[model samples]
Target: MALPLLIDTDPGIDDAIAIWLALAAPELSVRGLTAVHGNGLAGACAENAIRILEAAGRSDVPVHLGAGQPLARKFSRQGWGVHGSDGLGGIGLPPAGRGVDGADAVAFLAETLVQAAPGSIALAPIGPLTNIARLLREHPEARQGIREMVVMGGAARENGGNATPHAEYNFWLDPEAADIVCQSGVPMTLVTIETARSVAATPARIARLAAAGTRVAGHVAALLGAYVHDGRSDALFDPLVIAYLIRPDLFVRIPAQCRVATGEDSRLGALLWREASEGAPHALLQAPDPDVIFDLLAQRLRQLP
Candidate 1:
């Protein structure tokens, strides 16, 4: 049986690919998608989630809108440059065919997990931790239902950041929320910006799949094609979350402890992670074969539209 999943996201360009991947995967069942602010504004982020599900013909998956800004910080759109003004690289996919299921993303997250069987559901957060953090604070009871959370976040040390000199956008966008989730003591696996960077969707790779002549792949290629190519900005960061869920063996998991920089500065939203003692609940994940991951992307997305 497929493990049930709930994705907390912001529908960045790569986020669209991740949702497509989750829908295509046979080992997971997506119960819903909740949107937060990161790649774009909250309204656009929620709309993008709806559009993604509709495009993949998975409109049955409900979409919920969360807060438009971080829990303790004033909103800023500095991270919007990479995903473009409208996100999805501004390829202009049609507006969502349906509206969001409700106004509260945190409530949706808490209620869904609480209602599911204990340890039967997995949560994937592909954006800033705003919604997940809110859910954790408001409903600590729901944590018991989550089997394991696979999060896409943090800047790799080598890159410094995709957002700032010392921070990845997701963690940097909301350092307070990331800090809360990190210290929540929940079982979590983190996929870093480096992992996302390693599996880039370069023009060559994207074109090869676009030529397959399917609606889904072509749409994905067009959106990805519009990505701001700052040499390495077109990395498919979010999809790897789905791939990890399907094949954990393809990744190296190291037990670690993390601390987020919540102050406003160059290092704000930055995460400092260090290897931890044995059996730590938190881990950092890295992919060993990006080629195999790309193969999985092509094979699974080809199954859609």
Candidate 2:
């Protein structure tokens, strides 16, 4: 049976690639996409999600707009430089023909979880944790329905920060929300910056993708082309979450209890990892074979139309 899945995303340049990867994977049934404020505004993220599904000819999947800002912190102008102003590295695709779902992300999430079989649906949040956090706050009982939540955020250690001296961008954008989810007691697996930075998409890899001769492959190649210029790393951050679900052998899971710093100091959003005990909240991941992951990603992209 295909794994029931729902993705909450920000549609970053890499997010677009991740969505395509999930759509191409035969093992996952992506139920819907909920957009949050991260790589772009929530509205733009929803639009990008629609555009991505359109590109993959998977418009049957619904798209919903999510939280526009963090739970407590003021919104900041970030990610445009990395994901481009319009997201997708400003490689403008035509606007989506369909409209976003009227239901807000938090509501949609709650309804979806409640309606699905208990512990049968997986939630993948590749952006900030605002929507997930809100869902937990508004509908705490929804936890009973979730199978697992695979999150792509946080630096496992203090020195692993990608956005600041002590935080990753997604966690830094909404540390309070991260804190809420960390304590929500839902089974969680964290794919952190430590794992993402271990692998990169070099020009050679990009060439392999572009040579696949599929529309999806060409779109991914173009995104990577604009994303990984000047020797910049194109770590498959968001996609790794999806890949982990499809192929757990690609990584080693370290059971750990994680805490996100919600302080206003330099340590804000810093994830403190500790040894897991009874009833620990989450597990940290470490990738062992980046080449295997890259190969799998290429193989999957080639499967798309």
Candidate 3:
């Protein structure tokens, strides 16, 4: 049977590609999508989630809006230019045909975990940890029902930060939320920026995907085209989380205790990793072959409508 999944995302350019990959994968059955504010505002993120589902002809999946700002900090749109103002590289997809679910994202998450059998659901959060943190804070009991959480944030090393000198964008957006989730004692796997940056989407790879000639492949190409910078390749950030879920063997993981710094300085949202004797240890990804991962992504995306 396919693994039941709940994807918490911000619908950034890479988030859209990751959503499409998840929908196309036969091993995962996406239960729902929860949108949070990071790459875009909650409303736009929710719409982007629905837009991706519609593109894949999988509108059966529900989209719910989550936290609009960080737990203790004011909101900022500093990264909007990186993902485009609309979060889809300004590709201008039509408005989603369906509306977001009525239930709040936290409620939906708690209810879904409560209703599912123990260890039957996998939660993948590819954005800020606001919703997961809020859910755990409100309903700590829900952690027992989760099988494992695959999170796409954090930087293992101090110098590897993408947002600030010592922070990745997702964790930098909400350090308090990141702290809550990391300390929640839930089984977690962290795919960091170091591992993601190792996998670059080159021009050759984009051309290969476009050559597939499917609408999904075309969309993937466009997103990658906009994402890849001059003389630099786009990092498959969010997609690496999904890729790890599907093939854990493709990566080398280490056991470590992680903590997010919530200070209000340059160190804000910096992820601190260390060895621990007790507590729920997180699997920190080391590295994976970029060619193999891109090939896998290309094959999976071609399967979509």
Candidate 4:
């Protein structure tokens, strides 16, 4: 039985790979893609999601436009070093034949969860938590329908943030949204950059992906090339989020309590977590062996068809 999933993303380069993995892998049933503004504007991110799906020949999946910025924060310009101007590293991938309708994303999200089987839908967010927060706020009852939420944000510690030494881009972009989602108690699996940075995609791994003989693989490899030349060697960030859905056994899960810091200081977006005092597990991340995650990600990318 494939796990039904709804992806909320900002269409970064690694986000493109994540989408491909979701569409290509047999274990996941991707119900839809909801775009948010973080790596780029909502319009660009939504367009990129549709373009990536069509590139993978999976246009049947719907892509919905989401919030243009955080709930309270004014639109900020960030995530350029990684996502670049076009969100996909300025790579000129052609747009889809037609984008999704102009229906409001919050309504789309509420309707989708209401219609799906109870506790059968998984929400995987690879960008800001705006859409997720809105869903929780507007339709609190829909929380019962969620199986789990896999979020790619927050840092496990102060020094682990990718954007700042204290915060990751997704959380820093919208800490209020992260705070709301975390306290919602909707069974979430947080995939932090602390674990993801350890699973860097080496040159050889990128080469292997490019040689996989699939269009999706080739496009992902191209994105990897841009990332590498941009002075980063890891496609491990976003792919690990998708790869976790495909293969969870490869990572060691540590249930620890986590919270995002929303202070207007250098510590904003930090992930605060400690041993559970209430005798309950908190969040699971790639632990014990980070190398195991890199190996698993490479193996899965090689298997792309």
Find the candidate with the highest lDDT and give its number. 3
RMSD of 4: 2.2
Tens digit per residue, CA lDDT, model 1, 81-104: 767667877676788887889659
What's each prediction's TM-score?
Answer: 0.95, 0.96, 0.96, 0.92
Evaluate model 4: give its TM-score: 0.92
- Candidate 2 at residue 90, lDDT? 68
lDDT score, candidate 3, position 181? 91
Candidate 3 colliding pairs: none
lDDT of 4 by residue, 1-305 (tens): 99998899888888888888877677898988999998888888899899888776778888889999898888888656566767777667886789776667777888889888899888899999999999999998787778878888888865877779989889899999998888887877778887777766667767777667666677777788888777864636776777778788766667767777888888987877775644343565674354565445445555444
Q: How many clashes does the backbone of model 4 have?
A: 2
Candidate 1 residue runs with Cα over 4 Å from true position:
228-232
Candidate 3 minimal-lDDT segment of 10 residues = 274-283
Model 2 CA lDDT for position 133: 96
lDDT of each: 0.85, 0.88, 0.88, 0.79
Clashes of each: 0, 0, 0, 2
lDDT of 3 at 55: 88
Order of models, best TM-score first: 2, 3, 1, 4
Return the lDDT, model 2, position 178.
94
